[model samples]
Target: MQTQDRTNVSSVEAAIAASQNYLLSIQYPDGYWWVELESNVTMMAEVVLLHKVWGTDKTRPLHKAETYLRREQRSHGGWELFYGDGGNLSTSVEAYMALKLLGVPETDRAMKNARDFILERGGISKTRIFTKFHLALIGCYSWRGIPSIPPWIMLLPESFPFTIYEMSSWARSSTVPLLIVFDRKPVFITDPAITLDELYAEGAGNVKFELPRSSDWTDLFVILDDAFKLAENLNLVPFRQEGLKAAEKWVLERQEETGDWGGIIPAMLNSLLGLRCLDYDVADPIVERGLQALDRFAIETEDTYRMQPCVSPVWDTALVMRSLVDSGMTPNHPALVRGGEWLLDKQILDYGDWAVKNKQGKPGAWAFEFVNRFYPDVDDSAVVVMALNGVQLPNEKLKQAAIARTVAWIATMQCQGGGWAAFDLNNNADWLNLLPYADLKAMIDPNTADVTARVLEMLGSGNLSIDNHSLSRALDYLKNEQEPEGCWFGRWGVNYIYGTSGVLAALSLVAPQSHGNNIDRGAAWLVSCQNPDGGWGETCFSYDNPALKGQGNSTASQTAWAIIGLIAAGEGTGKFEKDAIDRGINYLLATQQSDGTWDEAYFTGTGFPGHFYLKYHLYQQHFPLTALGRYQAIFSK
Candidate 1:
């Protein structure tokens, strides 16, 4: 028994070392790590349609994009928003249309299957509103079918109830330019041959377009939408001129020096479309720089090409740096110092959109992307501060200064219920979602368990405690949020396991002995959900069906999350918890590839819950390392 225990220790230590070396080797000289944030084919499908709209289809490597789209097609012939999910109507429409534009024949096997699948699901008319918007730009879909987003909203005073400032930061940035495009309703005529006429099931002329009436408020908004369209057809909008000017100016001014907007693809692509509507010369510097920025988001290889939903160098670096240090890398190692120093330089000292609501909060913290200065989110800011906690930097004062203001800034961002959101402070106007244009239901930044738990973890890692004045209410929030079965909801990750792990970790650090009950219940729930194979998993379907929580095929990241959660809940003393942790750690060890990475084909990251998902290419890399390192720290002691 003693020899076996010794072997286990040696194995854990060896796994940690291999992961550390692998991550260290990949660190850029300037000090950061990044990888693709894969979402779905629609991202690249839009890229194809965007170039075709602007007549630059020949300029980019469209063939490479075509290759990627074909590779992602499901066995049934349509595309999905994430892996292993059935075909999504909107995604399939976009991919089919894009493939046709790239000259795929209707008679081809791939095209026939996609067309059959789409038509079986009610054709293009059944697709989402966003896909309709993309089709409208190329004249394949009617502008009349598209929902109205009055540009006049841009001219409203900030104090008004419906001002742009009320929307979430990402929604606001992406929508302002869209307001201009919706008003102009421009259609750049595409090649006569490049039409989606055959994809419309009801025939393009006969399809009825309607907004979903999920509530009485939405029903009223749908009627109002008709009124707005009638007014639009009559050119009766009062502030159309002023509205256009304000929106155009807002879009241009918000473009970062790096030429991206909102640091995401939607904003970048829509800004390009907005510029086209305004008659900007294609060769203009702003247009050229924006083009270059979008080009940088694309990753091409010998056979396939794809675009990331967004880049995450700062987010990835902060997490990876912390994971490496936790794995026993020396605090002052060159990798840690360089990565820490690089993060210090990325701090946003100037005010951003969050400042509009959190006026008392000073600007300090980092954003997920390389240069999205206007939107530094609380989630990323918290993790980055925690990541820098013990790292030794040459300019120690600089690190302290950044963390202090960040801590202060994060404090002021607490919502009404003592929870934190990613971007805005108290951005919980749920009624805004009733608007027809908010079909995605992502207009408001509501406080979520995953984010609040992460915030608590950051607080617990520092001077704050459960009884601290700043966190007493937050602790209550977490306590009340626990489900009857003991798991918590993960609004930003896959269902229950992610939320439970984060909350248990926070409780382990911040809660006193009196709080052990909450920890035990959560830890027990996690133990009960373990798969027969000894790992843990959850499906995105849980967002749509609560009963499905903590059920799916196990993957590297989710299993690591469960292990980290159990350890945080004091697993070592309990036979059940200890065995569960042992099995999980062993699963990670057995599944890790020879290159010190794990292959995760399933997406553990969440975009908009059920509607969208993401597979962070590095989630398989950094998370397991953190799990193993933290486990060694506790049991090996």
Candidate 2:
């Protein structure tokens, strides 16, 4: 057993060496880099795109990831949020497709297992909305069962309650291809392994296909059993033609000259596929340019390589910059200037979906990336302001303008109660969560503690309006949201610890004069929540299980978030905070591979609080820097 363990460790080391070299080559010329973003459905798109681009999918990482994914298949043969978990229908459908592309035969054990699971889970008839739509495209399911995304919504003025602009940033980007697909009803591929007869509902054959109408329910989405009723009528000739033209034009115009939508595989694939259905030739410049752009997102790491769904240079750079400055890296260091420039170049100058949806004047808000014009998130905006304030930009006018615009944007986004939502103001209705078959708990509106706290603190410190009556109402909401024990629940991050730390940090920035009152209370709560191992960790599962509160093995990343929060709350050198920081740094130091990175199988960030977690490759590096920087800058003295 000892010898086998040694062999396994050697193999991992070899693979890591190769992967590191490959990663190094892929770094952007600008000194920072990004990989594709991914989720269950989009992951498959990346797999297919990678295979097509590279002409061979044989890589050490691909094999390892494939093995992990297959091993994670549930007893019935489907994959979930984590590998070897129970199936999420959409994710399972995508995974099954990926395996097939990888040459897994229908009779293969993994494939058979997945098929059986799909059958038992009410078959494709009961699949989630997006899953059913994709299956219908390939003839595995019927198009009639899917809801419609009307192009007419585009024509709706910005003032309308349910304008397409009101959809989540993610939803709007996703909705574009959906609108195209809905209008054309393009079912281009049919799988012999699965068919409509194998999955459709009984006695539902021969019903004419209809599209789902759009509705805005500011209330909450609650699950309902009845089938979605078709809208009373359709606008036949003129409206249908108008919708079709708009859909086609939208798809073509948004095709990045490079062919990727923010360099994501699914959006690129679906849009290109729709264009093909419209008779665009494969050799057309639109298609050719897209293919070239998609190729750039792939990284050939060590023994294997895969495409990242999108780049995250700005996001990673911003966080790392803070970590360095906080860690005691002098402000004059060249790294700070290079990183600050990258961030300065990332701010959105034009109005985005926020402008259309909220009818707010076009104020600057930083988005996740440059080209994602749909929704400029409030959290990113708040953090950008904080990051910008840390480094001095050479251009004085530009710096002042950025500060003023960011301040204005954040102040407007603050809810009537003083907190901020992720994407919009006054849009946190739970009704979106009740999309009958959708299992995502994160689809609801964002009161998101971390985001709200960050916004309050950023605006408050600078003589901004984050302290207005509306801002105070937000603070009251945060206070009430806090558990009697003093911890608040994190909506976009992990569990109670994330919320507790965020609230502490924001309250400190707001009430710094109170000097350790709210800060002390928040600090006490965090100290109490610290695990015996001295580092902080919270499982994504904690969202579903309050009893599992603060229950996770020690991790460097969460420990850093917690430690930073505590320090920001004025507890920098407190016993528990210091202990947590020391242990977390030690954990990171011990785990660092020779390549100056750490591999954590546990996902520390949340996209959907109860349903999905993100594996941020840079978190282990940047976060440790932040925590360590804080220790050096303050405690070392």
TM-score against truth, every candidate:
0.97, 0.79
> In terms of TM-score, how similar is model 1 to the real structure?
0.97
lDDT, candidate 2, equals: 0.61
| CA lDDT of each prediction against the hidden true structure | 0.86, 0.61
The best candidate in terms of TM-score: 1
Clashes of each: 0, 31
TM-score of 2: 0.79
